[model samples]
Target chain A: MASATELRRTPLTALHEDAGARLVDFAGFAMPVQYEGILEEVGRVRTVGGLFDLCHMGRVRILGERREEAAQFLVHPNISKLKFGAIRYSFFCREDGTTMDDVLVYRDTDEVFFCINAGNRDRDIAWMREVVARYDCELQDLSDDLAMIALQGRASVDALAPLCTGEPPEPVRREGATGPAALKYYSFMRGSVCGHEAMISRTGYTGEDGYELYFAADKAPEIWNALLETGKSAGLTPIGLAARDTLRLEAGMALYGHELDDTTNPVEAGLLPKMVKHTHDFSGRAALEAAIAAGPQRRLVGFTTAGKRVPRQGYTLHLPGDDGGAAIGTVCSGSPSPTLDTIIGTGYVRSELAEAGRTLAMDIRGKRQDVTLVEMPFFKRDY
Target chain B: MSNPTDLKYTASHEWARLEGDIATLGITAHAAESLSDLVYIDLPAVGDSITAGEAFGEIESVKAVSDLKSPVTGEVTQVNSGLEDNLSVINSEPFGGGWMIKVKVSGDLPADLLDAAAYDELAAADAH
Candidate 1:
């Protein structure tokens, strides 16, 4: 028997099993890691479309007299610059400059909706509530009431437009909105999705053109089935968490456990520039300031293998010479890049050796393989 | 999943073929089905010594990576070089063409390994 806390089921649990998905516990939810296989799903999403059930993630709404003011205090100070109907990728930080949770903040006329990681839902809400205890803002935990599904790939809009059935609300011209809009990267508008009033965000964890649909929980099964039915004709495949990891790795997206952890600072993770906003004070400002002045000692960098061997997490990355270079870094995430036809990985390296074109080697099966340092976003496709 | 009666099996899902004193080892059909697709494989050197129940090689599928444990202690005499370019043989013909390594038995093959019928019963019970 499964413990009560062992796993939580989404509304589409039966659907996932019916589709032959291999279910595994992820962030407390019994999520699918693959339907048929990871590679096929990865390639399918890159070429066509993939439907994903993202209902396990948390959602909270901040509204009241001081909503925007309160949300600014909750997120990084740059939250104020996000235009209405646009999403800002940011993190909530602790006083020591460690990330509490990375989130996507969606701005609206009167409220700010925060989409947070599922594993940290309770802690995130409690922390935000305690911090703004004196304020007039209301933090409503809407996670249980809402469901999210992602449709991603070059054929995403092609499969999704029919379900929308109406015009996108108002143009929200914020940074990164046009990129998703031109490619429809992150521009979402409230409209009908499969006959249910829904909010569509052009964002995804997969490195492809995609839209995340947010709707009422009760309607989840219908929407999911509709997507799978409609998407089949457009070559859309139902993907799982396994493909999610590989696709994101190829695109160089940072995952919570592998890339970002409490002990690691975002600055050292190569996200310092995005974390800093000179406009106003926010949480973790002082610690981040100190780290900037002192300079981060270690940094996250990308490396590609010389051959077919995939360097996995915890693989030691060494400098080419100096007797394996004294173990300068450890690989945090890695896999074979199906799109590029090579093995690639992300790891933390000494700041001095993090630059692109630097040569490094990783020990695979007790043998060193040549690798090259490159800038992030290993795969970029035009939507 | 195929459970060939001609092969001797281990609880670790490896099948061993004994010809004289040389035993050729490969994963079983059930193991291949569980692993899904094979992408990358790391084989032990031809002359490396392997102990019974010890990991001799690693194989990676798209989602997971697992080490293949040896069924018998031996000195590796030969390895299936074709598997370097054709790892899918593990999924297609795990009993024959998918044989991984050939070993010269260091001692008697590890005792208590299951026969084909016994392995089928073990696999069926595990499926629950």
Candidate 2:
């Protein structure tokens, strides 16, 4: 019910408007949807370089006497699989197995840095505090004091290499922050970026090769301008949330409200393997186990439309037939893929009909149109 | 976001051109500007009957999808099929190459349509 003006503004809000971006409210914060065009930004991120302002997301630091033990209460049981200085994608779930929110966990020696969805920040913070009360760990919300920017694409490595002036530590290299760019994927290092203290991580939701730079909130505008100027020659373009959705969908990544929600469990969402078998017995483990054992009655899958007409969310998916058509599922997220040059979407289909290559149809304005279940991700990089 | 003086405008942002018994229709430049960066368009087929104030087509930009309503009652005689390949022309040349369809007048055109100045007044009021 809130207007874009009522949403919180990031430190770089002025900069975005100055660049002629179309701003809209997203997750309770005014955010840019695109500077020029979604198609162009999508193409640029896949090929060259792209920048995204992700300042609206919530950032929290967890540290204390029993940080390791407390993590099981804070995140998924898969926290054990994440190495120090690395980032792992996971979900924060309720005891009923419904998702509270999805988040990215960054492991440090004595603490975990958590990046949560912007809209759920207040609720997530309160829940984490209540859940971790028994433990010695403390949860600190850092959202108001930090700004995050993502530099993504194949050329992002070389573009960020110049910022790391010193011989980067091995931990930094492992998390995709090495200056020479030998760091593996999903890694990060805390160091100086353009003379500002920053955490540069090799992680992005766009499914492209990229880095995320987190810095002090006050330094956001200067750092954003600096990155634009420095990376201008490398064909780096400022991307908006519209392009962000298309890029993630093409990569088969999940969005919070669309693919994963309060009623959607990780197993049914097709993320069962990463459930991390009771490693420390985290919350929602029992329900997740039961769901996994019951074999997830509904499954999320990808489909490509036969025509340019995009299948929007809530559109009923039907199985084609000569006599009375039967409803099979519903589209959760759908859009015209700017990169693929056609329509693509994700849907929850009955488990029996979730196989790749299965034929499906979507009721587009009362007319049933043919669609095909395809292998996710809808796209992939060569190397 | 130009509202050409020669064209009559609808409050819904459509523009009408009445030439003899033919009415050429397209979205105004202001409409295209408000719906920045066109992505897809579903143009009405020729021979489809359209009534004034009724939806005749659909247009989608990156962030949202909007309906294109008819400003005059008529039977569609032609559609700008070129939009099937290039929708951005709506942003570049909305009045000319981006015209949506041409219709043969059936009944009387809507009398409530506004000229350029009147339409501009409506636009300004909406802005406030």
Candidate 3:
């Protein structure tokens, strides 16, 4: 109705429409927010398998001899030390000690691939170009050239393994010997799935045992339908962005703008472990070192409300008391988790108040309801 | 999903049915559908006074929370206590067992209340 002149559509847009998905504008792309419902879809991903249209994410390939070096220099993590066919989750940050975006870097035999946020693709690509200019690397935007589907849950492997031709190569196990152990969570293998060459990665955002399949954009519908057909017995359902958000939130994974941003450093985001002990001059390294010396004043924590009230984003949090209660933080991601069967959210609060079991009052609309600070990753899969 | 023809509707998607001196109120089918997967509904206590067009309760779905505004000014005689155990009725049978509250009418019915046809038109327009 707003003149479909601006928003981009993914390759599976027609299929989503046919399946009666409720499409909404996400990062300038018309994407499916939900099909049947968030509760049912997300429940499917947790119990059985659920397929996701991750075509909205950006995929960039870095080529040439110094590709690994170029990719290593941009992020804070030790990407240079990553083994072949391995993926590292790293934060791309500005020089001012704040995050630009959280990205996944893949080390392949020939090229380094980056999975970046769709909304920050243009900015991240520009930043990457600036960083790689110093190294002997050729950068190319492959986002439009690729389509990604994340099949996640306990039932995912049972659904996906039948399509893939061979078993993934054995990963470096935690002993003197080695064998494939559930694909070893952050690694990938190149194999044929549904007769199409796919880079299947164990990396996932939903904190489930799953696989992310990447291939040519044109082959999306074929793979989508094939997976659905093959996975019907495993109860594989087509999931949408709304359920993705809820699943990731329940897993305590941060959304870029909500949990990490240009104004906030990673230390406050409870991601200091991700920052390797580095001497190299990476973007944000110097400012981050300085911030560490001064100590981050706030910390990210998980909070849950009593069953009736849902603490939504931007809700002001305060320490519950009578003496002009002190404001503490703001709710970043909030929703009623179908898995947990209650309201849960994550937010940043003063470092001292970030402990579990602490009581905080979350202002839901005008009422200050009781919210308890608790450990995150609210739902964990046994598998 | 259809709103009962005998019930009076408000612009905010509330439905009220007058039975002698008392009125039973609940959200319409359109409103229930919008609030899919209803998790909680905070109904007003019995004997509480309610004002027309003012929020007397709250309803929550996974996506959002909305205030439940009263359609007619009166005293709340009975709250849907059974709905506390089974909230799915709000989405499944909003016009029947999902009825939220009963109020004793203190005065004449509000003037702007719409019939079924008019309410459906308003719901359609609001969607657009």
The whole-model lDDT of each prediction reads: 0.81, 0.82, 0.83
Q: Give the poorly placed runs of model 3, Cα more than 4 Å off.
A: A1-7, A133-136, A166-182, B18-22, B104-115, B118-128
Best prediction by lDDT: 3
Comparing 2 and 3 by TM-score, which wins? 2
lDDT (tens digit, per residue) of candidate 3 on B38-126: 77788889999999989989988777888998899999999889997898888888899999999999988889889999998988765
Error of 2 at A182 (Å): 3.6
Residue range with the least summed lDDT across 10 consecutive positions in model 3 chain B: B119-128
DockQ scores of all models, one per candidate = 0.40, 0.40, 0.38
lDDT (10s digit) by residue, model 2, range A1-383:
36556778999888888898878878878899888877788888888888899999999988887776777776774565666777888888887788988888888877888899988899999998876677867888899898899988888877777765433346546453436376567877777777888877778988888888888999988877777777789888789988899899999998989899988988888876445556587778888888977798889999998776777788788887622476779888877787787789999999999999998888876767788999999988877
Q: Pick the winner on lDDT between candidates 2 and 3.
A: 3
Q: List TM-scores for all candidates, in order.
A: 0.91, 0.93, 0.89
Ranked candidates, highest lDDT first: 3, 2, 1
> Which interface RMSD values do the candidates have, in the order shown?
3.5, 3.2, 2.9
List, residue by residue over A1-383, the lDDT tens digit for candidate 1.
Answer: 34323589888877888887877778888888788877778888888879988889999988787777778777774556766677877778888889888888888777888899988888999997876665777889889899988888877766776666544445553444322243234556677778898888878887787888899999999988887777878788789988888898988888877778788877888777544546767778888888878888999998887687777888888878655457889889888777887878899999888899999888765778888999888998874
Q: For candidate 2 chain A, which ten residues in a row score worst on lDDT? A: A171-180
lDDT of model number 2: 0.82
Provide the lDDT at B106 for model 3.
Answer: 91
Model 3 lDDT per residue over A1-383, tens place: 33234579899988998998877778988888888888899889888878999999999989988877788778776666677778887789777889999998888889988999998999999989887877868898988888999988887777777777644555422343222234667888887788888888887888788888899899999999988988898888899898899899999888998888877778888876344676556788888877777777888899777757667778888878633466778888888888887788998898878899998888776777888888977977786
